[model samples]
Target chain A: MGKVVLVTGAARELGVRFVRRVQREPDVDRVVAVDAVEPVRGLGAASFVRADIRQPSIGTVLAEHAVDTVVHLDAQGAGPEGRAAGRAFAKEINVIGAMQLLGACQKAPAVRRLVIKSTTGVYGSAPRDPTVFDEQTVPGALPASGFAKDAVEVEGYVRGFARRRPDVAVTVLRFAQILGPARESPLAACFAQPVLPTALGHDPRLQFVHDDDAVEALRLAAGEPRAGTVKAGTFNIAGAGVLLLSQCARRLGLLTVPVPLPALRWGGGVLRRAGALELSAEQLRLLTHGRVVSTVRAREVLGFTPRRSTQETLAAFARERGAGPLPPGLLGGAVDRAAAVLAGARVRPPHRQEAERND
Target chain B: MTDAKVIPFGDDEGRPRAASTDRGARPRHRPSAGGRDPRRGGPPLSSVPEQRSEADALPPGRDAEQQGPGRQETGRQEPGQGGLLGRVLGDAWDARAARGLAFLRRRLTGEYEVDEFGYDEELTDQVLMSLLRPVYEKYFRVEVRGLEHIPSAGAALVVANHSGTLPLDGLMLQVAVHDHHPAQRRLRLLGADLVFSLPVVNEVARKAGHTLACAEDAQALLTRGEVVGVMPEGFKGLGKPFADRYRLQRFGRGGFVATALRTGAPIVPCSIVGAEEIYPMVGNSRTLARLFGLPYFPLTPTFPWLGALGAVPLPTKWTIQFGEPLATDAYAPEAAEDPMLMFQLTDQVRETIQHTLYKLLVRRRSVFF
Candidate 1:
């Protein structure tokens, strides 16, 4: 018999995309997408159920659907209105919502596999961090608060759930920043700005996974365990290679203003207060000391590799935003011309030919 | 020709007016004395004003006479370009200039690649190494020996004695390995957390292929067949007073040996002489160090007294000698976990470096020579 999959956080773009992908999987007999708010658009073949994971009533939806597989995708930082919707509300949806969802999943005996969407933010960016983090590397510094803390809490709850239900295969896919033309993430918003504010003297290595690859990874993890794939484990899902923040800005043809860490944080707070941007403390830490994780486990065990590299992913996002004031080709040409002129002036005497002719 | 030399023509206007006066004053004695001058063939006094007008109109032309040989040599090197336009373009579009422009274009377009550790090989090779080459060649006059001890391929750990109030020895060692080694392999140094926590130093360190001095990073690099350099006597040796020079500090719990054993990378003991006398740290101010969050505030004779000028290191002749490699592949993988084995290997490496330092110092004639 094919598997009955239940995906949470169906209203979000990533969630909706994941639901659409999973519903088409050969092994997925039915897909029940659950969310507090009704999706603005259609979910195709998948059925949409209006149920908040924060409440115990989510159990009824799971039991009614006989969900054999649960894909939790709602553990996100902020919402459509950004952090303007108060931290408490976001935390409630991310932490409490995951807790309640796990509770429901545990009671449903039909559920044999659980896949949770996690962020690499759990690794916490710090100066002392390892150059590249694998699955087993401990976070150098645990995040004090913010979405990273929430991710930590949610992962802890998932671990507890896994221990309680040893029969169920729990897969936690820790993904790097997800960027795509259709997605609207905090990083995307940051890139959308004309002037990107970066931490002075820091060009942290950043990694990104295309949204299509992210959905594909989720689909792979949610499906039934195949011969070459591990059924359940923690895996880092990110595109190969890394891009420096300055390089990203250059690629996007955006001007970068290097702000001191303290002033940048203060400015970020002001921007957040003014509802102009969403620069959380976690994001500031990320900007200061970029985080990169090894996706080897995801490739080796989970049987997933991102189709696009970090550079390619950024290019796609940049293409979607249209050309910036200084396209890379134009900038490169300008630099070449300036260098040629400087070189010419430095080597050749200006009036040498005229003096030789006169003589 | 004598007038050309006397007038201070050709790009002099581009310089400050005071510099032009200084140049004109120096050449005045030659013409007034009526001495036998080199290149004395010149036009009569009647043509002097016309020549001056020509020089004034085409200032850049004046340099061609002075740099005539160099311009001809450059033209001969680029044989295809014979016309005026080609000559002008050829002067600027030499092979070196072309290569440099290409590198700049690649950087501006973000086309170059950096490894997962943020190591940009192209930038390190072309830019960083060239910038350090002058100091490595002239300032330090480093003499490298026993380079054959380093493996031509595969992983090898180079444990060097750390001294010098600043960490210039590490950079010099890096240059020595790259310039002197037959394979021209790059040395990936593992630095302390402090090296990565600072602002400008952090970026340069990462780009120059230095990672955090952690066991995990070391193992990762070693397993990738990279030649990794480590200074086990970190701050303790670097900040030690001149009295303690050449005395290797405690090799930080033998962590490097453990990592080598884990990765089965041979440990090549490196002893560096002359670094100890560069700054001659006389004292360490603990109070000031704590106030500034520094590990140790060095009190050298010139520092703080001479201000920024004091930061300049004394030109001391340097000798970096690599000792025989200690093979760790013979040991079982479990040997890394054994503290006794780790201690024994660490002590052996430390003794080798200390003994080599004494040998180099005994053979040395003077520190500044």
Candidate 2:
């Protein structure tokens, strides 16, 4: 018999999209979509169950559906909007909701597989951090507080649940910064700005996974182990290669103004107060040091490789946003012309040759 | 030599004039050329006088018309200018200018690629190396020896002595490897975490292909077949007083050896002379160092008293010698874990560097020669 899958955070766009994709999966007999509020659009063949996972009522929804697979994606603070809802509310939905959901999963005997969507932020950015983080690499500095902390706590509860239910195949996918045409992540919001403010003296290496790849990775984790795929384990899900923040800014045709670290923090507060892009402490650290994770395990064991590389993912996102004020081609042409003019002038003077010969 | 090849062209252009002016400028450049000792085997220095005479022979107004864009295509009125020599020179100059412009365009458009570690190979080669080349060539007059010991390709660990209060030696060593080696290999230096913690230094260090002196980064670079350089002495050797110059400090915990053993890359002990005399750290202030959060506040003879001018490193002749490689592949795979094996290997490497330093010191004629 095909398995009954329950996906949390169904009202959200990513959740709705994931629910639609999972409903079409050959092994998924039924998809029970759960969220605190009703989704705006139809979930296609999947059934939407409006039940908040923070309360014990989520247990009734799970038991009623006889969910054989649980994809817990309701952990908040994944996007800027979630963070804008206030820190406490996001934490309650993330930590408390995960705890309640995991508790319900532990009691459900039919749930043989559990997949939790995690963020790479758990591996906090620091000066001493390893160049690339694999699944086993410990974070250089554990995040004090932020969405990263929430994810850490949620993963802790998931670990507890896994230990309690050894029979269930638990998969935790730590996704890097997710970006796509439809996504609205903190990084995406930062990129959308015409003028990007970056931390001074930092051109951090960044890794990104396309939103479609993220959903695909979740699907692969939630489903049964296909041929050549590992049954269950934690995997870092990110596209291949990396991009510097400066390179990203150039690609997006955005003018980046470098602000000192302290002033950046102050400016972030001011911007947030004015209902602009909210730069959390986690994001500030990320902007400064950046984080990159290795997806070798995901490729080798989980049998999932992202379709787009980091550069390609960003390019696709830029394409969807249309042309910025300064298109890359125009900027490149202007630079090339300016450089040609300068070089022509330098090589023009015969006396310059005498000066060079003297050196 | 490159000088001999250029002389034929100079003779063709201004043979009579060169002979007349050669005598006058020849004596003036001799003293400067003699400053570099001939016993120190390096790139031939005889080219300096020949090139200087060639430049002196050229009439300053001869190429005035060549500056105009219209005159570039049309043959010069002079009989010698229309030959293959002039065409080749003009084409070469245009090509170089075009290449430079293309590089600028790539940098502006962010079209270049950096490795996962943020090492920008193009920038390091085209910009950073050229910037440091003058100091490496003219200022220090670095003479490199035993460069053949480095493999033409594949991974190798270079353990060198660290000195000079400001760490200019590391950069000079990088230049030495890049310019002198047969393979023209880039040295990826393993630096202290403090170098990475700072603001501007952090960005430049990464761009110049220096990573934190941690085992993970070293192993990764070695596995990728990069020539990794590490100064095990770190702050200890760099901050030592003038009295301790050339006395090798303790190699820290044999970590580099273990890393080499694990990766099975041969360890090449490099001894760099003249770096110790650059700043000549006479004393260190603990209070100032603590207040500034520095390892040591160095007090040199010319420093603190000279203010900003004190930062200029003394022009001391330098010689870098790469010793024979110590093979780690012969050892058992688990040998890296054995503390005894690591200690023996580390000691062997350290002694080799210290011994070579003494030898180079004895051979040196003078510090500022």
Candidate 3:
């Protein structure tokens, strides 16, 4: 508990909040915030180091810090782009960078807990059917950017390392779409539309974890006594509320635009072959079929109690950004557009149908 | 793929009747050759490379049979029946061939039925009991209880802890349900996916009607109102080493309960005594499995590559007992969605199996067939 904690990619929004959370936690004595970008202003006396985790020398620098709890949040393409660049960057930072950091952490005797902030995208895109994807379900990730796949590979390494060294608690927290003030999560960009796009007959099951809860889980993971992969091995951290894309658009008061065409089954293949996309069709399938990772493991293992609801998360972001109300016809526009293609197709809410039992 | 369908050598009646005098004749070919036929039925020499002699082809018993007479006293062989020498050589040879073929079947195809009992008999359980009764009466005693625990008719989930060395517990439970229980029924088991994937395994597994181990498969079987048997312990519990035998591992977040919760079938917990000690798994080589993509490399005493293969299952008198049915209709389908509830139920089933194993083990007198 007296050891120093180093959070990579600490200058980013989620990374910064994580550093702040670690700094606030009673167990953490010192935090060394490391990032390739310029250090954020006013992060108060907490040590700051500027170094890209992808660099080979970064491990030596981290070892020099004498830091123990290494919370790796460093990754690339944390922004929207035309696939290739995003994927290359994500692999470099999340996968390659993580391995570099992990290699260093393995050498450092002081490092007891290495908490890596992974995405549930590692779980892959959602499924077409609304089945609750628990920790038990095998991860069938979508082809989006290579971020999820890369992060998942890193997680496998982390799990293997944890198994090898029971002394160091290696925690891989798979978070949902993280959204908060100034945070540029995929969800933020996803909801940043004047006309929110929607998938027809597919209301992807999404898990949105607030930055605060996300950090709290990391803090708890860093402090827990047991070191091995906890619970279903991977915990699905979501916010208090679960909502579909259409519902989110409705809540945002944004204009919904539904394409009348069938689900974009061939979009990923076309884009990848054209060198415009990095994710494969399987990866896209992950996106098409959303996941529901059971949070029971998190709650039981880490005693996780989420404070912010999905509505609260969006509203707080809106309030902080001073964003105005959503357009009135946003939701109806998409529904009307979808209905125009298939007449009499009911525009029912996604969660209206109860989760059917496999029976 | 179709090559998997070739009838086993012993079962090949379609071989030209004229060739029967040659390799087809029971004990004739062996003496003509040097003690054993080099052209024995084994995996294609291409895959395995080593073609063993009659003595070396099979485990020891095979040699004994081949060394003995396989021809009848009348010097005549029936269509199905084998003479004294034929019984010894044929049974031994067939069993060896079965073992070799079963192995190749598992490796190539990935499907194999792991029968807890020796074989599937068509006769009624009472008839089976009548056959075993003489043996039971001569060497050991038999008893039964909890006949009412089984359902009269309906597809039920017979959830049981599987761990009688080579799955003897599963066989006893099948027999208990078939003979002792009020409603005579055949239990369709949810076998590991590997059982169906392996070549020869697929044949035996399909014959036994054991499907892949998954909630979807279990639910489908149960939806049709078939008696489904499930071993929640999976590989962890089944493959537990000898020292840790009978100590149940965590039942993977109760897919069985979820299956029942989804299908509204009553989960009947079952316990079979005298299975764990049959041939305690001394060790399992995971390294081999990783290399072979198999679940584990089980190393049991009798199965030690080269030795007396028929280490007769310590026919430790087995008694199967079915516990009260745990109904799932009360819980909504979404109720199965509750991870906590699933975990709790999984643990309950594990405990029930463990407690039963301990009781059964205590009652067991010795280990021998």
Give the CA lDDT, 0 to 100, for residue B106 in model 2.
Answer: 70
Comparison by DockQ, 2 against 3, better one: 2
Task: Provide per-model DockQ scores.
Answer: 0.45, 0.35, 0.01
Write model 3 residue lDDT over B52-113, tens digit each, in one string: 13224445653332222222111222324332333224433433333333333222221221
Tell me which of candidates 1 and 3 scores higher on TM-score: 1
- Give the clash count for each candidate: 5, 0, 39
Task: Give a tens-digit lDDT track for model 1, residues B1-369.
Answer: 121111122333333222111211122112222221211343234333443453355436333222211121111113333335434333333433445566667776788788889898877775677568667666776777888888989999999999998899999999878755766678999998998888878888999999999988999999999999999999999999999889999999999999999999999999999999999899889999999899999989999789999999998888889899999999999988999988888999999999999999999989987
Clashing pairs in 1: A349-B60, A350-B60, A351-B60, A351-B61, A352-B61
Listing every candidate in turn, what is its Cα RMSD in Å to the true structure after a full C-alpha superposition? 10.3, 7.9, 23.8
Which candidate model has the greater TM-score, 2 or 3? 2
What TM-score would every model get versus the actual structure? 0.86, 0.86, 0.45
Off by over 4 Å in 3: A76-85, A126-130, A140-145, A224-233, A260-287, A318-359, B1-258, B261-369
Model 2 - which docking category?
Answer: acceptable
Give the distance in Å from residue A143's predicted Cα in candidate 2 to where it truly belongs: 1.1
Q: What is candidate 1's local distance difference test score?
A: 0.80
